[model samples]
Target: EHKGAIAEAGGVKALVDLIFKWSVGGDGVLERAAGALANLAADDKCSMEVAVVGGVHALVMLARNCKCEGVQEQAARALANLAAHGDSNNNNAAVGQEAGALEALVQLTRSPHEGVRQEAAGALWNLSFDDRNREAIASAGGVEALVALAHSCSNASPGLQERAAGALWGLSVSEANSIAIGREGGVAPLIALSRSDAEDVHETAAGALWNLAFNPGNALRIVEEGGVPALVHLCSSSISKMARFMAALALAYMFDGRMDEFALIGTSSESTSKSASLDGARRMALKHIEAFVLTFSDPQAFSAAAASSTPAALTQVTESARIQEAGHLRCSGAEIGRFIAMLRNSSSILKACAAFALLQFTIPGGRHALHHATLLHTAGAPRVLRAAAAAATAPLEAKIFARIVLRNLEHHQTEPAI
Candidate 1:
């Protein structure tokens, strides 16, 4: 309430002044201040107001130099909030200023203390969302630092490795950062993590692979370098239920990425600013998906046999009576159409996954495959969408999972003409 009053009393400036004085006042004061700043930044009004007061610069420095790891964590969090808010505007100048702030953050990414470095990597990722910050991060050698962190995870504490892998995954999602990640030897480390004995390490590795899969070029490398087989093994593994579930979720995203790229291929499309890269990416993605399907279809006789030996692991997959595995397991139009039909079943999780899988077909140049193959149109999709929307408005537990469905429908709707 007092914080609300401070925010209401004089807007963002009051909070900014308080944060700066408290943060720079010394260890205890800085920690207290960082806490307060985090609270304020959580609210958009306060965040935008704080951004107005050179809050970015102060938070970045605090994140860099603060001795107390807790204070640094809070400061890093505040920076993430601020960067998230600023990057949303698409304002070049605002992003450029934030880029300058990221330079300091990159330094902290290599901090002697592991926790501080983790927090710093997360902060850099938040800032790097925008083009300006992406350039800034690349310039500051973020790619090298993140890769090194992932590599050292084997020797580092489990908690530190988890944090480090997560940060690298965040950066890997962006196109600019994807190139850097590849150049910095991140792929091998990420693939290696998929097979880590630690559950946390496995989850982090899957998350990184999901991010890298966003770029079609990386998908084949991920498969050739053994990511898909490793992840498939984990999904079918009996080691840990949670790890298997996460691996399944990550593969869902990777599969969606491949389908999305395939849909963008050769539509005789007029060249737009996005034409070159998008088209190239689509071809690469199609090749990767073809290879993945070939291997996944016959895992026992596939190229990477070690990663495919998961019959023991397959028993661990908790299958619901309501959800049936695709018997034909083909990527043909009829197969996809049947999959969409399965989504309308009463189970929210089933519906959500189906909706997402359907979204992959909406990209463009791929309409012909579905047109002849039994894919559902927008009219057929709305029923599942309405179910998801209703679920999203229900109580919290039901809401989060349902939101995923709604988001997939919305993403597909954004390019309706395609």
Candidate 2:
């Protein structure tokens, strides 16, 4: 009846009384009270009542107590609910004066129980959503704690890893947290997690990588911390399609500005040689386009391939062609080169990929290569047509690919001097 009455009244007074009991009474009663408070706090009415009855201080106390896992989780959840209201127009001043609230929440991130830790991480994420709270989290080693959790929990439950990684990801997106991630030895663990056998782990790792990639300095750290190799391996992993896509998308992002860095891998003699020694090994990095094209045999696979490639790299070549003359082409050229190399099993899909990759090249020299390749196709160049017709099994798509190839060449064709 008491529980039902609390629920009926939206549980405000009961939650407040329970939180008071937890704070002042302490022990079995506190645990029961904390749980009741957590349940009641789920309703704004009850949460408001608890807030009025010193619930914030009580929850903070539970969070700081090392022996109370159940209490800490309940406290974290209650605090999360309260902080979520910090954005309310009327409660701004009240929340601002909730001294030690942020500190207590940060402490819960270190809770022995994963549930409390994840909830704490989530609450911290919500709190840091505010610029003011972001500064506070940064000052209180929140980023460091989140990153540490991410690293330590890499092999734990995928859910816990994800929550920790997601928190780190959110933190890393901020410049302050990005630096903290680097300083706290977080990049290596994220890179390692990116290579995990679990799809969820890989996705969380990818998100973390994406957040870190937002900063050029972090991108460099990712590379120096051995992220590149792990990402490259992920690109070719037969594990989860989503993981592969994320790997590809991330590599594409890295290559956007760090094209030279990729040159070391793409143009490596060992990669290009494709010697008998690697006969049974997975396809080399230079052959990524070929691998992508092969996957097009299945529509689902094609969709996966598209998802994996960067959107910036997916734009029509004709569109990118105009600006291809600048630094744009340099990046495009590398992508096109890889696309061409991947076009071994030619089809309209392969042609489109090749054209899109080539379109990024605007330099006269790059255009000359594209022009040459196109001409060979126009002159009924068997190899050129075959490469361009990679997706030719689909007739309409094939015809379109042929037309695009011819038109691309026609635009580049240099007429004899008058």
Q: Top TM-score: which candidate number? A: 2
Model 2, range 1-418, lDDT digits (tens) per residue? Answer: 4544675675556655666655644666666666677666555555566677677667776777536677777777766666665434322233324677677777777777788887787677656545666777777778778777877786577767766776676566566677678778888888978877777777668767765654556665776677767877776763665455445544544434343343235446755553332222222332553354244334443344334444333224233223332221112233334444433433333444344333333223452555445435444544554455444354333333343444444445664422
Report the CA-based lDDT of candidate 1 relative to the real structure: 0.55
Question: Which predicted model would earn the best lDDT?
Answer: 2
lDDT tens digits by residue: candidate 1, 1-418: 6656777777456555666676655677666676677778766667766666766666766765666777777777677666556434432235347544666667676777777676676666566555566666777777888788778667766666666676676566565687668667788888877787777777767766765655555654565476666766776662554445445544544444443344345445632423564445434433433333222223332223223334432222111101222211123343444445545544444444444344333322343423422344434645654565466433221222233334334544555453
Q: What is the C-alpha RMSD of each candidate to the true structure, in Å?
A: 14.1, 13.6
Clashing pairs in 1: 236-313, 333-373
* Candidate 1 positional error at 10, Å: 4.6
**In model 2, where do residues sit more than 4 Å from their true spots?**
1-10, 40-54, 65-67, 81-97, 112-115, 233-246, 258-418
Model 2 TM-score is 0.56
lDDT of model number 2: 0.57
15, model 2: CA deviation in Å? 1.8
